[model samples]
Target: MMFMMFSPYSFLFFSTYMLFMFSLFNITNFYYYWSVMELMMLLFMGLSYTLFVSSYSQLMVYFLIQTLSSFMLLVFYIYNLPSLLTMAFLMKLSMFPFFMWYINLIYKFPNFMLWLASTLHKLPPMLMIKLFSLELNTNILWLSIVLTVLFSGVMMLMVLDLRLLLVLSSIGNNSWFLLSQMVNMFVFLFFLVIYSFSLFFLLNSFKGMSKPSLVSSMSSNPYALTLWVLSISGMPPFPVFFGKMLVILSLLMTVDMNYFFMLFLVMNSLMVMGYLQSVMKYFIYIYSSNIHYMLKY
Candidate 1:
């Protein structure tokens, strides 16, 4: 039913992503972990769809579901109405200030579970935010956007572990998706697909190498490494580049595009580019040496 509800292109994209996950991690080794996370994600998505269906108004659906979930947890007894819903949504996304759990999960969980947590698990909450955002305050939205971008960018720069770097990158990408919601839904979906594909190949590269200290040193296949770097950086010619271009063009068309917002976008783009430059430079260093010399370091 959910498959039918999604547009054909989106449905195909989701199906392909699932297939990539299954193929990347042989099912037998991670069967139990995969099944549990899949069930939880399904339940979350199901409830979101139910809410969307039950109420004609998107805002009312968000309010009612958020309230009901809170009541179930006895939150209604302790918190005011607005706080209840606010806390629920923040918890749902594991957003700023409440994001410690999310970071810990990424740092501790096995690759299979971390994949779900950092990617597919974000979909339901993000979908609800997109649907119910019609009347969301623009000022508050922009504030959250700025915080998300800044926080994620800082974490990405600070993280040394390759997996942790990917986790922070995923968070930044999620923020970009949220920003895309304000611009264009089609572009958002396209961006999601590109990110998923890039992540899949990047993770594949990680599996082939043992060292987690240096991503370029660890990537045995330079071609795959280059593709992953280019795609994530949203460099020209990649599908991600087109997706990002559409988002930027859409944002430019918006009447509310202020200098501050434009400056933020430029900074975010530069941050991503800086990371990619370092990755590529390291890859060049590795490639310049003999295999033994590269591996020794």
Candidate 2:
């Protein structure tokens, strides 16, 4: 593979340059858009190397490149490009539905790389709020929010893997919550930190278990996974809960309460019940005589 032939640093440099060229050539007319595209492209290219390249020495370079590119993009948005800024903003945010690339990357990359992806890529959406005038169209914002929430919720429900579910649910809830604008900004940040930390811990904790245990824990046990899923789904007390609370608060303030509230409650409750049933089945497995057979090699 080309990845194995070149040193990570060399490969990263080459990739970055290539991406720069692609963006430059494509956006000849739209110079501002081209620049933003190139910057994001560079960050994405760097992310690929950071994840795939085996060399630890290249880590700092990769991070530095990503950070600098991101900073430049942010400054450009804040200053020069107000018209297509929101599009650039959405691209940067990597929010749900608009997030297929990110989710695919997460699935392909190792867990540790999630740190860089989550931290660096999360800024664009947050910064978008600052660029918007108070009079910006609420309908488009709400539509995006609703779609993100529903799609994420359904995807989480369907996904057999907890990590994937968590990823989807987090994106969904956070996108909707951000749209609501009811919660203080600090609360959203705090929730994100806590949720991310918890996911890291949960994933690491199950590392010692056998393959079957891991699979069953993810697939068969409703009771065992209940807390984990609920926490991720923003049920209550968990950090995501605050995000959902803010979203709900926003909906109450702006939209028709009856329909939105019903939709929110019903969807969330279904997710909760789905995880609950799975957890309950897992616990029931503990008491079954076939448990030994299930655990046996």
lDDT (Cα atoms) of all candidates against the true structure:
0.56, 0.51
Please list the residue runs of candidate 1 whose C-alpha ends up more than 4 Å from where it truly belongs after superposition: 1-39, 42-87, 133-135, 208-217, 277-281, 284-297
Question: Candidate 2, overall lDDT?
Answer: 0.51
* Candidate 2 steric clashes: 7
In the range 146-187, model 1's lDDT, one tens digit per residue, is 666677777766654556766666666666777676665576
Question: How do all models score by TM-score?
Answer: 0.64, 0.58
Which one wins on lDDT? 1
TM-score of 1: 0.64
Error of 2 at 142 (Å): 0.8
Residue 134 of model 1: what lDDT? 26
RMSD, candidate 2, Å: 9.5
